[model samples]
Target: MPERALRNNSTPAELAVWHRISRFRPAFTRQLVEAPFIIDLACRQAKLAVEFDGSQHLDSVERDARRTAYLQSKGWTVIRLWNSDVLANPDGATLHVLEKAAECLGGTHPQPLPSREGRER
Candidate 1:
């Protein structure tokens, strides 16, 4: 399916996760296209792709593995989250994404500002 259509028809789990991650820095793209496949969500700067999978995905483990391998070959780190888990605990799911992103980016996102404890104000 086209990227736009997949984004427009996002599953509940995807929407929940996006709601939390979309507000952060280094921004994430939903329904991102990487040629042959459409990523559920991706932080391009970090080269990280997050995939939210539903029950149907259980039937296609090999297909998903191939997709992940292809993306990995292209230097993308893929993280998969179950739909049930996201719906049950969106905060935890988003935190995992943030942590992975930070790991991939090699530092904290939005880096902390310099302190000015003694500056005139």
Candidate 2:
């Protein structure tokens, strides 16, 4: 399917994951195109690609492995989550994504400096 169509027709698990991770720093894009593949969700700055797999994936283990290898060659960290897991525990799934993103992004994100306008003269 076309990327745009896939974005518009996201699965429930994809929607749930997106809702949780959309606010993350470095940002994430849904149905992001990466040459031959369209990532379910991707944080480009972190070089992280998140995929939500359903029963259909069980039959394509080899294909998924090849895809992972290809993405890895391009310096991307690919993480796959089961659809059932995302639906059953969105928080846990979100945390997993955050952890992987942090790993790919090299630990915690840099904190911004506090504003000085509130300080007394």
Candidate 3:
């Protein structure tokens, strides 16, 4: 499928986020084609889709809304994250995706342990 080609062309942010969540018990597939749409990353078993959007999306709010509505209508919970956010704070982005996935799967999301990297001394 054409969408499968996207896996190898993902942005750095997408790769970072995918690397973290791909280790989940259920697993997520990148560039999953769901007919009318191609999800960035999806855990079909949990009915969750995670999209990493760049600045272009900010100018396409309506388009994004329509896409999101369409996906939600099909029983998929969509989580859209800015690429900058994913790149700048991979742990935070991963946490958000995991939480959303847990919600759609009817389970509690696990929080990452506190870290000192960006914490106040």
Candidate 4:
């Protein structure tokens, strides 16, 4: 799909976060897998899926519960961030997300700093 179109369809909140994250590397977003389920945002290698929770969930608690159960059954770890969280603590939230993903992938929490000046290798 075209870049302009993607931005146009995304929520302003989602777009803002995406813009910041895209500065380094793009994080995956809405995707459909073999079945009909469309994930909010996921990383297959990281085995992580991120979602935004809103008032709608309160109205459909059972449905959300089932969906969470299904994903967990499939071995996918799901993380939920609230709309207010994205608005209030975008930076901290981003770092927390990166930390969780790294943890799941069995890597260091804070990606190690770049190799220093050569000491004559």
Q: Whole-model Cα lDDT per candidate?
A: 0.91, 0.88, 0.85, 0.64
Best by lDDT: 1
User: lDDT per residue, candidate 4, 3-105, as tens digits?
Assistant: 4454457654465555555433224545435143555566676667776676667797788777777887888788887767787887876776677777877
List, residue by residue over 49-91, the lDDT tens digit for candidate 3.
8988999898999999999999999999998889988899999
Q: Give the range of the ten consecutive residues with the poorest summed lDDT in model 3.
A: 107-116
- The residue-by-residue lDDT of candidate 2 on 1-121, one tens digit each, is 9987998999999999889888778788999888898899998988999999999999999999999999999989999999999999999998888888877877865233478987999
lDDT of candidate 1 over 99-118, digit per residue (tens): 89998999875334678889
Ranking by lDDT: 1, 2, 3, 4
C-alpha lDDT (0 to 100) for residue 23 of candidate 3 = 78
TM-scores for candidates 1 onward, in order:
0.90, 0.89, 0.85, 0.74
Query: Cα deviation in Å at residue 93, candidate 3?
Result: 0.6
Taking the candidates one at a time, how many backbone clashes does each contain? 0, 0, 0, 0
**Per the 3 Å backbone cut-off, how many clashing residue pairs does candidate 4 have?**
0
- Candidate of highest TM-score: 1
TM-score of decoy 3: 0.85
